[model samples]
Target: AMAGLTTIRGLVPAIPHAPVAARMPSEITSREVLFVKSLDALQRRSQLSLRGSNLAAFAGRRTEDERSRLKRVRNKEDRKQAFKDFRAVATVVSALFAGLAVYLKYSDSELLYDFDITDDAVSIIAGLLFAISFQYSSPLQLLLVFFGKFETERPADWVAARIAGVDDPKAMTEYNAPAYAQVLSTALIGALGLVTASSLSKLGDTWSLSTAVGTAFLSFLYEVGRPKRLSSEEVVAREEQWSDFRQFAEARLVKAGSCHESEIFDAFVAAFPQYRDDTEGKAAFKQLRRFVYQWNPTAERTPYGFYKNVALSSTFEKGKTSALDS
Candidate 1:
């Protein structure tokens, strides 16, 4: 009797998805049956995994996706190495300029008189160049890359991993600790540049202004030339994926007549489990919300905060009445 009861319980539908089963008419459509089955499968898989499941065979698909992502990251790293190489060159150049600044500060160089450039001017120029180059190849930036922080090429996956399964205090205070190294390194580098400029400057006071000027100028240039982070191919692929998602969402909304935010979010996550990452989930939600608003210029909100196209008002009303009846 207990074995029979256990079997019966196992066969019963989950509460969250029961409405679909209950609302089925005597002659149910194939699409409705498929949707119910998909929901059941997702629920079952979610019980097994901490992260929710999707409609597709997530295990196999995720493995394949991981391989593809690794390949892309490898390619990105190859491209990023070029920037690092440039920065390394900048580091060397900055060192050389620093040496020149020191040499001019000590030596009574006749060259400055020949060129009509005052020693103060030459010192400021060398210091400016050093500061600019150092911005690209700062000691702190190089060191942070080793620990995998504050890098343009660093993937979000690692940060997510670091904070995973930790309490709020541990997550903030331990895993996601403050960036003391960055601050210290920045201050040291700035001080070195200022001293180099001041020691070499005749006025001994202009280094402060010169370093600031260099920082502002280099920051502007860096901003202009900074990488977009996504490759051309990735950008195109992302657009295609989003297009596919938009189509799926539109079809699902039309089938349901209307949907609340949670329903839409669940539907999207069911279709694209890869976006389950916290940051990605937020982005996907924002995109989906924008799509919803754009789908119907005059959208109406149901009593339960569901959104529906005004054109589908009749269908939405019928669905709502049926749901309430069930």
Candidate 2:
């Protein structure tokens, strides 16, 4: 009976040992499962961080693009406002000058007043105001006011050529001394007529009328005989060439096919705002516009030949000398 009890006790201890060994594998498996879950969580966090970085980069690019677009829009608006301001100032000054001219004309006692204190003062004031108005006006308008119709048509080419140091080919074509002498003689004759008319007017006689008529006729003849230091023919030719060039330029602008003519015109005006008062500059612009019209023949009315002749007299002088030498 004692031997049987010892064997039973040994069996009990063996049973407990077998259970402990089996439980060790289950605990190890549980720890491995937890580690795997932690790794998965860490991987998910890394992916999220990468996605956030990409999103931020995209937003930064979008912001830069918006800023660039805004800058362009602001610049365009500023240019437009500047042009409007210039025009407004010019219009106001022009009106004032027109009023002054009317006042002077009606207030004068004589049919033609000499440039006395009153006359000189009015002229000075009017000229100053006119000059101011022309400051921001288009070059074409200013040229017309200063040089009349004689210098407008080809002023650009003449100026360009002069700037480019081209010698006037027509200067020597006419007799220089004779041309100037004729102009001086004509001017002197006109002055004499003016004097005589004034005297006759003071005397309350009809002599003023006869003297004026005679002076007019004499002046006309003198102008006809006067040799141009710059040949009129050359001036005309240059003007025509400039006109052609202008047409070509205009055609290119039109071909650009922009919907905004005003925008284009404004850009042109902006580029040459000083052209409004620069006689030659304005003429160049007018010629360009006219050329465009001629090319298309469907454009609006253009300036008359008034601003076409303000060329460098040196050109004509050279031509005259050449002719004399020849």
Candidate 3:
């Protein structure tokens, strides 16, 4: 009987087993589904927040890079404009001096209005001579030639050394040439004017004090008004750069086997640090290496060889040519 009862109980479904409809929770009918939807919405919001942060970081980096590029371009333009402005001012001053010279030459009776000669004939001859000599080989032309020669034939190592503030006698010699030339030219011109005045006085022709004063003033103006005479601020800035260059050059010389190439490269690099990353620097360095190591046998020899050679050879050649012509 018990076995039969057990069988009947097994045939009955368990109390916990219910229809799917009856198993549904009252919470689903009330607010449980809404809570689940809210949870899904919160998860989506979190994902969007992370994506926004990443985008913002990317944008910030891009902005910084753009700012850096723009600043560099602006700085380059400013430097170019400054150089142009300086050149323009120099050109205007030169033009004014030239005009004064022309006026003086034209107004002088000896130059343009000789008493014995017809005005038109004398003026034409004087004008032609003046145009040929003074106009063609003017101060501006000389200045340009001087700088051109300096930039070309001048030893790059010498300039690099000067920029580095090297104290070697050779370096000083190289540095002083340009200044010497300027002073020499001024003195020579002044002397020529004086000689001309003396000759005129001997001929019983007097020149006004105003003319002499004007000649002196022109010489002074040309010397002082030159672009090479830097402003106080520019001098200070260059001196600071020179100090840095000297330090860097010294350090570099101590390295790289203490060779001349090393010294030259170090000086050049310090003078033009902006070129450190460029192919120009590499080429310069290579050339410097050849100059110091291959061309020069004695590294201890002063760097004044080229300058001395040019000065001596040119002087001798000029003397010989002058004698021959005479």
Which is the leading candidate under lDDT? 1
Tens digits of per-residue lDDT for model 3, 88-129: 334433444355446655675564333321223332233222
lDDT of 2 at 104: 52
Write one digit per residue (lDDT tens) for candidate 1, span 1-326.
Answer: 43544454455444326576567763554555565666666666656664444523565477668768978986787567557544643554455556555665666767634322234555556555545545444435445646865543211212333334323321232113234433333334444554555554545456545655665465445434545444455556556657766676565555334556666677668777867765456667766655666665566566675665422334465666233324
Off by over 4 Å in 2: 1-48, 108-326
lDDT of 2 by residue, 1-326 (tens): 33544555445444435566567787765565555555556666667887987875786587668658866875676567446534543454445445545665667566434523234443334333323322222235334544543322222223323444447624332222243333333333223333333445554344444444443343334333433333444467556556545543443343211122233334445554544333334455555555445544543331332112111123334443222223
Q: Which of the numbered candidates is closest to the native, going by highest TM-score?
A: 1
Q: Rate the local accuracy (lDDT) of all candidates.
A: 0.51, 0.42, 0.41
lDDT pick, better of 2 and 3:
2
Q: The CA-based lDDT of model 1 is what? A: 0.51
TM of each candidate vs. truth? 0.35, 0.23, 0.25
Model 2 steric clash total: 27
In angstroms, how far off is 230's CA in candidate 2?
54
Worst 10 residues of 3 by lDDT: 305-314
